[model samples]
Target: MGITLVLMLIFIDSVSTFSISALTDSRNSTTEKEGKNADIIRSLLNQETIIRMALQQNVHILRKDLVTIQEKLTDVETKMSRNQVECTSAMSKLESRLLILIDENAALTNAIRSDLENCNENQLMSSMEIQQINQTLAGFDLKQDVAFTVGIAEFNKTWNSGTLVYNKIISNIGNGYNANTGVFTAPFGGTYVFYIAAVEYEKQDLGLDIVLNNKSKVRLIGNNQAAYQTGTNMVVLSLGKGDEVWVKRSYGKGFHSHGVPLTTFTGFLIKHV
Candidate 1:
């Protein structure tokens, strides 16, 4: 019985040792699985962190681009506003200048119109005066020849050499003498007697001539002397209708008209041709 008890005790000791070895092997396997899981989780966390950083950098760049675009828009708006103001000012100035030009053009037009009116009035007056002269000339009776006498009224005046003396009208009968032109137009074909008289100042020469159709008919001359002198000339002329006659200085010498009717030209119809 002692041998059997010793053998049972040895068998119990071997069974305990086998159980302990099995438990230790199970714990080692559990620890290895946990370490592998932890390593996988850490790698997932690192990938998440890299993704977040990339997203943050993109957002920052986008914000900077937005600010730049906004500033450019503001600058463009400012330039547009300034251009608008300048354009408005220029337009206003141009309008004002146009208005002034319009006013000036109106004034010039008015002045031209006024000048034309005055010119027309002057022309009308000249026409009326000519008409009156024609009427006066037409009033003469052409049935018979008549006589007329005319003289220069300019006294103590120096007449230039070679110039006709024609300034005033003393008398015009039979509508023969034209004061403006210093000419006598024959009223009818007739034999006429013409006479001319002239007086000069002291120490001055005087000359007178009767001209018919630009032909010298008669001449009277007075030389310069110590005293004033008078000259007279007479001529008989046969004139036709529309014949012209006048008195002129024959020589290029100065003459002075006395302060009287001393310078006289007379013509009378003797008989009709």
Candidate 2:
């Protein structure tokens, strides 16, 4: 403002001096000369006044422009600073949130691991319980704690003594089905192979059919039935525990009394190979 004022003052002095010189020259000058000087001075003064007014207006406009520029600069700087602070705060908040999530994830992982360990423990316990149950089932089949096998004794349908000791006999088999004299109960659970032999009234055309309970196995003698009177007829079978082995003789519809005893062909429990 002070520099603009000094410039304005200098411009006004030059215009004043030119106007004074024109007035002095006009008094001793021709009409054209006076008019020319007067016009020149008037034009000069008008230009100077217009220039001064333009400068003053320009100065005021420039000052206001500068003030506006400074205010805008301050606003921009303030906004930039605020943005930087906001960015920093947002970054800090994001990092804290991420750390918290990581910690939570770790805790969840540990919880899952603990649950897995508990499941494994339960599995082990269940396995032990199953083992105990199987042991109990295995013990159920044993009727006696000890095993005692006596020697074999000869069985005769008529009468017998010695180790045979009168057990039971049924010789009056006529028609229909013939039941065995001995009934051995199952003592344990295992495979048992039985052997039986029958002596019939010798009908060369009769067939001897043998069947086992539990469908353990079946043996039929149709081949030797044709040679019944020739020699002893034998049948072999394999059975399971609690299986009843029975034999029936069919002699072409005759008064048959299978003379060949059920014990003639003997089969005892043999060890599994």
Q: Which candidate is the best by lDDT?
A: 1
Off by over 4 Å in 2: 1-34, 37-41, 141-273
Task: Give per-residue CA lDDT, model 2, range 1-273, as digits (tens).
Answer: 999999999999989999998987776577778789999999999999999999999999999999999999999999999999999999999999999999999998987776566546545754664576456446454333212122113332332111121122332121111223333333434433343333223333333333455232433332222222212232333444565544334333221233333223233333221
Q: For all candidates, what are the clash counts?
A: 0, 1
| 160: Cα error in model 2, Å | 74
* Candidate 1 steric clashes: 0
Q: Of the candidates shown, which would achieve the greatest TM-score relative to the real structure? A: 1
Q: How much lDDT does candidate 1 score?
A: 0.73
Give the per-residue lDDT of model 1 (tens digit) for 1-273.
Answer: 999999999889888888899888899889999999999989989998998998899899999999999999999999999999999999999999999999999998987776566546545754664576446446544454567777666555466444355555565668788777778889989877787766666557777778999899889875654334556677778999899998887753554564456577777776777
Candidate 1 residue pairs in backbone clash:
none
In terms of lDDT, model 2 sits at 0.47
lDDT of each: 0.73, 0.47
For candidate 2, what is the total of clashing residue pairs? 1
Pairs with backbone N, CA or C atoms under 3 Å apart (clashes), candidate 2: 199-260
- Cα deviation of 269, candidate 2, in Å: 30
Worst 10 residues of 2 by lDDT: 159-168
